[model samples]
Target: MTTRPLPEAAFRVLLSLIFLVSGATHLLRPEAVAARLDGAPFAHVATALAPSTSLVLLAGVALLAGGLALLVGYRTRAAALGLIAVLVPITLTVQLAPEALGPLFKNVAILGGLVFFAAHGSEGYSADRALRLRRARRLVPALS
Candidate 1:
């Protein structure tokens, strides 16, 4: 027998964990992240945002909010789009170097997945579905 694939919800959860951990890491260790970016070409952009720590922490909070929303299937499309917005600049600015090919590829792959999710939405087992179902149920009685 062929092996069964994981459920869509499980896949979503697994995928979302990446962002969750990344966000938490940024929030908990902004200094570490800042240190990594300290000498990067675009470090000035981050510095312009005020202290590097503040900017990094803010990015982390945004990631956390988007990741949490995606995880719960609440406005998943929007959440995915938000992640895409955040990832594009990062991939462009941080991962475009010769030695950064791996990170660049990874970000591109994640971006592709987010684009698909944004287009198709959270297929089922989500707050969006639950709300839709509830609304449909309410409408049915009036139609009847």
Candidate 2:
């Protein structure tokens, strides 16, 4: 049997969920994540912060905000772009290791998805669509 294609909204939600969980984990377990990045370039940036965890928390917050925006289809392209920014450095610094091939490839795939989302607006069931609908309604007078 042929498989049906997933709806755009459903796909967006699924993708956003990945970031949501990852962001929450980063915020909740900063030390563990920091440990993973111990020798990475990002660790230097984190060290520059007054508290070592501050930079990690900041990154988490950015990820959370971007995920939320993507979930609701609000400024989706911007959200996707933000994710790509975070993912690029992470993939290079954290995931690119001889024993980490799986993770590195996964990150690359995720980056591809984010790029696609950034290039194409959320298709349906999104705040952007709602806003557009509202504007259209205002522009077209009600039939009396």
Candidate 3:
């Protein structure tokens, strides 16, 4: 059988993997994550919001869940949008420092990726497709 190509889905899955791994690392070692976040430019907002451990756990869980949703192509656009929303606060809070330019660039790149995915559904290899198809079928009878 010929395999259908899914470049968009693949790109999304790869980006999701990156988020998942980062989240897992933070969840597994809150202190380490805390230290890193503390040193970053956006530490002030994080510090103001919650304990370092709690922030790490919350961010980690969000990333993991969002990543999984993207990976499975389930509501992928919504998931991508959610991930972007979550990152915005962190990005603004932490990556504002001049010294944090490198990380800031990376975050910007990820943001762009999230936006791209948000606009384009995961094509054929996604739950969105099934849902869309169902909706289309439902409307067919009325139109006919």
Candidate 4:
């Protein structure tokens, strides 16, 4: 019986795409998000959790970079972990509000994905695989 390699790369791609889209949405329309945020029960927490649009921009960059890294299976574990770092606080402080259970569910879903990706990175069809293949090729002896 053959054991198929896990679709870890695909998982990363999914996680990355989710984060990239969300980050882009927030970054592209900060005012809209900020407006929603201002009166939220979690507004004070959001202010401290995310700080400002500059922090939001940095979060956007991190999300984009981390997502791309995960999707490409390049340093996927690191990227997944980085995303978790960015997500955990927001998930707790903002998404977990009593009045925002719907958003909380979304955050939880992403958090679950991040945790999974952090533990298991792209095992199949990954940049790591390509690197391994290249290294193997170099190690093979050439017979003249």
Candidate 5:
């Protein structure tokens, strides 16, 4: 098999897999996902923000959209920010406990990855880079 040279793009796609799958699950199984919120650490606050179903749907949409963008490296920083928005509450409510140390650390690592995208923006093999290149090409042709 040929080796893939674009590590950043590969990392982004790898990181996005969980969000994509989880987002679909949230959207498709809102009731089941919402049930878990009943026992979550910040269930009251989460419900206070919105009814559990509505909250799940909102988070679902955010995660899916953000994951898609991240996977393609389009608006990556903004996408990371949006994922951060969804993840922070979920991490706080669902994964923050002594009994959940493994999941908690996993979420923390995901947060770190998201933060890197937020801080550094897109890498070379990204839609952002492609668009920027296209724009530059058009401008250069116009000037010539």
Candidate 6:
């Protein structure tokens, strides 16, 4: 909440793109995502807990909801944490493969981005900032 402008805003939007796109894909074709998990090393781990398609759809909902919230910088820290929750299981189950080194590394990078937002939150031109300012305004006047 330092009120810094542009940089963090840009970062949030950019980081949200992958989740937005992937979430849409998951929702639109959950069966496909489930199919992709067929040979995954951790496939058993995932299936043991729940059906692949059900998990895929749940992840999709989390991604889409979190991505939208992050994009607008509304409850950004919580949104980022929610996305991280979805990302960890997906990466472990789907991307941790010998042939998926690139994707695994990509998920790590995404995790880094989410961690930053979760720790710092969002500022400047954001719903969180605007709401905070509004609350401050109300409190200052009432205390007078």
- lDDT of the candidates, in the order given: 0.80, 0.80, 0.83, 0.73, 0.88, 0.91
CA lDDT, candidate 4, residue 6: 61
Off by over 4 Å in 5: 1-5
The model with the greater lDDT, 4 or 6, is: 6
| Candidate 5 RMSD to the correct structure | 3.6
Clashing pairs in 6: none
Q: Please give each candidate's TM-score.
A: 0.88, 0.84, 0.82, 0.79, 0.92, 0.95
lDDT of 3 by residue, 13-104 (tens): 78898889987987899899888778876677678888877888999999889999988888988999989977887788778888879988
Clash list (residue pairs), candidate 5:
none
Can you write out model 5's per-residue Cα lDDT over 55-114, one digit (the tens) per residue?
899989989999999999999999999999999999898887688899899999999999
Where model 6 places Cα greater than 4 Å from the true spot, the runs are 1-3
Better of 5 and 6 by lDDT: 6
- Pitting candidate 2 against candidate 5, the one with the higher TM-score is 5
RMSD of each: 3.7, 4.1, 4.0, 3.4, 3.6, 1.3
Candidate 3's TM-score reads 0.82
RMSD score of candidate 3 (Å): 4.0
Clashing pairs in 1: none
Best by TM-score: 6
User: After aligning candidate 6 to the native by TM-score, how far in Å is the CA of 2 from where it should be?
Assistant: 4.2
Tens digits of lDDT, candidate 2, 41-104: 5555546554556666877898899999989889889999999988787787677678889988
Ranking by TM-score: 6, 5, 1, 2, 3, 4
Candidate closer to the true structure by TM-score (higher is better), 1 or 5: 5
Q: Which regions of candidate 3 deviate over 4 angstroms?
A: 1-5, 134-144
Residues 1-144 of candidate 4 have per-residue lDDT tens digits of 222346565566766788788678778986665666565665677577555565567767887788777778777679889989878766665676677899889888888888876776656777866887888788785532
